[model samples]
Target chain A: MRLSLGPLLYQWSRDAIEAFYAERMADPVDVVYLGETVCAKRRSLATDDWLALGRELAGAGKQVVISTLALVQAGSELATVRRLCRNGEFLVEANDMGAVRLLADAGLPFVGGASLNLYNVAALRLLRGRGMVRWVPPLELSRDDLGDLLGEARRAGIVLETELFAFGRVPLACSARCFTARHVGRPKDRCEIVCEDYPEGLPMASQEGEPLFTLNGVQTQSGAVQHLLGHGGALAELGVEILRLSPQPAHMGEIIGRYRAALDGACAETAVDRWVTAPLCDGFFRGAPGMAAAPDP
Target chain B: MKLVCPAGNLPMLKAAVGAGADAVYLGFRDDTNARHFAGLNFSDGSARRAVAHAHERGCEVYVAINTYPRPAGWRRWQRAVDTAADLGVDALILADLGVLDYAARRHPGVRLHLSVQGSATNSEALRFYADAFGVERAVLPRVLSMAQVERLCEDSPVELEVFGFGSLCVMVEGRCLLSAWTTGESPNTEGACSPARAVRWVESAGGTEVRLNDVLIDRFAPGENAGYPVVCKGRFTVNGATYHALEEPTSLNTLELLPALARAGVAAVKIEGRQRSVAYVDKVVRVWREALDTCRRSPEAYTPRSEWMATLASLSEGAQTTLGAYDRPWQ
Candidate 1:
């Protein structure tokens, strides 16, 4: 399966973001989606800069896609949806229906983001009819659930590529209010870019002091980074064309290289065997509680 | 217009109708709806009685089968939906896609309103639901401004009902799992937010602090107003500093914005106090009813009285109110 770098879900400086993507372009990623998928108040990178970066990445032979916010809170957000859909040279990943409607109205092909909750096969076929070129299943979906959807899509003669969230900190859900910022004593309006403080997001603790969720702006993520390194075989069996590696700040390059090595059949099974105790999880894919990391397969 | 109000129990159902609410929205005593607090909601008998009482008043009753339907509680939620349909309620407010599809197919004539927990923020998401399941109306999330709601109403073919007054949800419905993160009960499946079980009221040296799941959210001096325990509205430490990270516990009091919300194409204005006393529901509903009636009569001449504002503020946590995301200049 080809690798696609999902949009960065936190706020980082434009220079940091640009430098990250500039380095990532030469890496093994085939498709790169750039833009903020979490909170919109983050202004480190404007749409123009994102587009310029997309062009630069495209010049380097990576297929580029632009992502809209998970929660479109206004007309200006809708206007951003319009711009993303109408913008040439980049495919749009429709996170909310605003983006989907704009792209559908423009009669342009797009990607169905995980936030849109495309669960059933009928929903998948409906999204496909609405100019959806590929679909990223919602984060909580299991293999059986996806198998059911894939079966339905295949039976209906729908041609669609599926991408799996193969790595990085899992985005559990998105919200309109900024939890990370609010946790830092900031309103969403004056968020002060607190999400930039924790590249992987600030950690949340349970009452008993267990590390629970990572508070990333308005997005709440899994405390455990999702390690799906050896699961590539299962994804290939499931007919998933692309594996999504979400962006994190530290060890991203090494993480990408490991996944690349895993994909190229260069890594031993023992390398991924230790994945169980890695402090992250992949239980959602295994149909268990999202926080429960299963024994190594 | 349907006056949908919260009913924490059967008595609340009676109280809601008595207070001019045309309908009472509630759930079973399970993780089925947004207010799945212990000792709240109904048993099978109460559900039947609630439906019977509302039907007798010539008003409607809806089952808020609105939570995300967690994996552990899916069967209970499924059973709740089945029982609600069998009890013959006028409509069911739903959030989960699987539940909606099941409700649509199983009970063809029962009206289904998309619960705010579905979080259909944009027309495409709304249209996706409308075309798929034939949703009649949608409870709008509290994130939209009046102008933005008007823009949304243009494409929202279904009836759009906005929350007029109550405890404000800072997060978009369905999209929020913070409660689950802290307490393991989400609106999606567990049907509660920062639940009472996780909340603790403790007297500390700094102040009287309200903690939700070990997170110290708010600390007030003795005799100061104490807001309910919720994570987003509490005080916390981050980056070696302390602050009110999310929102302070200020229950939503939009008594002044009824007319603007009506003009913004809101089909129905909702009052949010299901957990409140019958007396509180009576007071707030009567005042809001007067305001809504006045606005409906002239569409003008509605002015904010300081006393009215003060009374509402006195009832609020820390005596504060924000137009919320409605007034906030959203990016």
Candidate 2:
């Protein structure tokens, strides 16, 4: 199966950010999405720099795509979307419907990002009609959901390219009120870029200290990084065209290579277990509770 | 201005129309709509009578088919939409694109109001719906400030509606997983937020604490009121301290800012909670209707009343309300 690196959901130093992609140039991932998919204030890598990186990654045999911010708030954001759409060097992932409209009007092909909530076959059909060439299923879908959609696709006499969020921490939700900024005691407008400090986002816990969710600015992520290593065989059997792995601070390359190995059936469950820190939780894929780990009860 | 009040029951529907609500929105007993509470919503017969009673009083009846339908279970959702169409309801408040496509195709002439659960954050998404399907109005998410509301009106063709009062969700509407992460059911697919069966209220030595699906959300002291334990508004620990970090139990009270919102190009004002008692709905709706009428008389000269404010406070979630995100100082 093809591996796709999702857009960066965090803020890092410009040098480190550039180096991440530069190192990935020699890596095994098939697709790389680059841009500030989170807060718009992050200028660590300028738009032109992102385009340059796109060209460099493309030159390295990686299909590059520029992703727009999930929350496009104002006129300036619309202009930023236009700039991203005009680059023409790469495809764009329309996170919001506004960006989708911009990409559609600009005569550009696009990928349906996870934020748009493509829950049903009809919604997928509508979005695909509007230049959504490929789709990243909503974050909460289970294996049963995938099965249902695959069945729908078979009946519809069409096959849409599908990407599964196979690795990294699952993004649970986004809010207009930024919890990360709020935790830092700053207004969203003057958040001081505190989010830049938390490389993997600030882990929040219950009063009893049970790890629950991670606050990443407007986005809340699952506390445990979602691991798809053990399910490579199941994923391939389910017809996922691409497996998406989000970027983390360290060892993402090893993670990608692990998923690659698992997909090829070269590794046993014990071999994959060494790559993942937590017990497997593909129950969402199997139509059970989202938090239920695999080897379902 | 027109008022769209929510009704989870037949009495609430009649009470809403009795109190001069321009429209009453209710959902099927099934999960086809938001506010999919157990033993709430309407039966097929109640749905028909609710519409007839509201219509006979010159009040419009709008059915809510808002939640995203899970695959293989959409026939009930389809039947609800079609029944609302055949029943000649004045409108169908919708959120999911698939539901919108179905309504636009099967009941082309049925009026469609975008549910706040759709979370149409800006004008472009709102206008996209207007262009794709003929959406007439949209319930603005509570997150937008008044200035943002004015900007959205400048861009979109649809009539913009803002929440006048209700429970304030600190998170973005429609895109929440607090329920999914906590209980297995969720508002996105199931139309219920903080399902009651999953909740437990306990009295500890420190106070009364509310729990949802075994997760502690909020704790209250003796003689103090505790709001329902929604996952977002729950108290949690970060950096070794626990706080109500999201929002204190507060109802939204934009009634004091009616004139300001009216001047901001809001076409109509909405109040939340279909599960509230008729007494609460009638009082809040009556007060707001009076407030809007007063605002229309002279926008600048309108003075909010203390008694209305008291009634609002008494009827609120935690006996407290703010001009939620209206005056950012309060936000």
Candidate 3:
């Protein structure tokens, strides 16, 4: 399976974003998802800037896909999705149905994001008919669940490239109220883009001081980083075509390198467990509470 | 605007209809719906009687088959849709794309309404559903502002329904995983949040400590009135301050927004307590019925009354209410 860099879900300065991608030119990732999938107000990189970067990345022999916002609440947000779908220069990852309809109506082949809730064969076939080429199952799907879905899809004669979220803190929830802004006692609209202060998001802890979650503006993420490197061989055996690693502020290059080694038949020798700063969790793949961490088989 | 109420059983269904509900929504006695609480929902026999009772009272019954079905349970969801149709229910409230495809193809004549779990927050998403599955109405997620709701109602290809009152969900429905993160159950996959089986209320030195699968959600002091242990509404420390980091334990009471919603061309107002008692459904439905009638009779001179607020507040979660996301100051 190929390693894919998922969309940047946090806010960062334009210079930092550009410099990060400039270094990604030499990374082992096959596909790089560009554009912001979180809050729309995060305009560190504009639409034109993203297109320019996408062209630059493609020219460097990298496959690039522009992603739309996961939550489109305003008309302006919808307009942004339309612009991304009509870019004509790059394939778009449709995160919501609005983007899906726009791409399907334009007859453009697109990739469906994890939040689209495509859980069954008929839905997959219907979207494939509507020009969907690849799909990322919802993050909550376990190994057994995905195995059954992929098996069913093959039986139905529809080919879908499957990408699984393999690393980083799993996004647990989203809302209209921005918790990052609310954390500082400011309203969503009046807050002066406080999310930029948190490159990895602010940490939410239990009353006993145990880290529980990360509150990124409107998005709540798991406190434990989901590390599936131990199951790299199992995922490949399950027909997963791509493994998605969400972008973080630090040590991403090293993280990608470790995953590449694991997929190349390298045995995880307990050193891979220390890759992420946070505790590792793989229980969701074992059909248990997502926060529980089981020993690598 | 039509008044839609939730009923967990035949008695609640009859109570809602007698209390002047225009439509009553329910789910089967399994994990086919979002409110898959123990001792809740209807059996096949009870569902048939509910449809008959609602139809006789000039009301409609809509079965909620809104949970996302994995491959193992996909046929079970299809069976639910087929059974609801066979029972002569007016509409099938659904969220899964495959289920919608199955319902549309197998039961063409049955009306389809998009459940709140569909999470279609904008007009374009609504248009996609209308084109794909012929969805007649969509229950809006609680994440939209009043202005956004109004714009959607004006331009949506299908009729729109907004939540009128219930225990508030801080995160958008069908998109949250806090429940499954702590407990292995979610509204999307397992059809429940913080499933009762995983919950424990232990009286501690401090007070009652509520835990979900050994994860301490919240602890109440003496006489602090502990609430249900939903993961989102639990207390957490952020920046050294312990508080309801996501949202406080409160109910969403949109009775005050009735006139504005009616003027926005909203087709229906949905009351949201499927796990509640029949008396709770009866009282909440009656208040909304009277409020909607008065608003319809005189749009210009309508005003919210203190009695309506008091009655709703009395039965609300945490014994308090807020016009969540409707008149939210932070939108």
List TM-scores of chain B, every candidate.
0.92, 0.96, 0.98
Q: Rank the candidates by TM-score, best first.
A: 3, 2, 1
TM-score for predicted model 2 compared with the true structure: 0.96
Per-residue CA lDDT of candidate 1, range B1-331, in tens?
4567878887777877877777778888877777778788889998888888889888788888886543344467678888999999988998776678778888888899998887888776787678767998898888776677888888787888888777877777676655654555555655677777778889978668676656555678887777677666665554444555455677676667776767767777787866777676766666666667777787788776677677677666667776776765431
Q: For candidate 3 chain B, which ten residues in a row score worst on lDDT?
A: B322-331
Relative to the unseen true structure, what is the C-alpha lDDT of residue A137 in candidate 3, on a scale of 0 to 100? 91
What's the lDDT for candidate 1? 0.75
Q: What class would a CAPRI assessor give candidate 3's docking?
A: high
Clashing pairs for model 3 are: none
Regarding lDDT, does 2 or 3 come out ahead? 3
Off by over 4 Å in 3: A266-275, B328-330
TM-score of chain A of each: 0.94, 0.93, 0.97
TM-score for every candidate vs. truth? 0.81, 0.96, 0.98
All candidates: DockQ: 0.27, 0.57, 0.80
User: Highest DockQ among the candidates is held by which one?
Assistant: 3
What's the distance in Å from true for residue B94, model 2?
A: 1.0
Query: Which residue runs does candidate 2 get wrong by more than 4 Å?
Result: A269-280, A295-297, B329-331
True contacts kept of each: 0.23, 0.47, 0.75
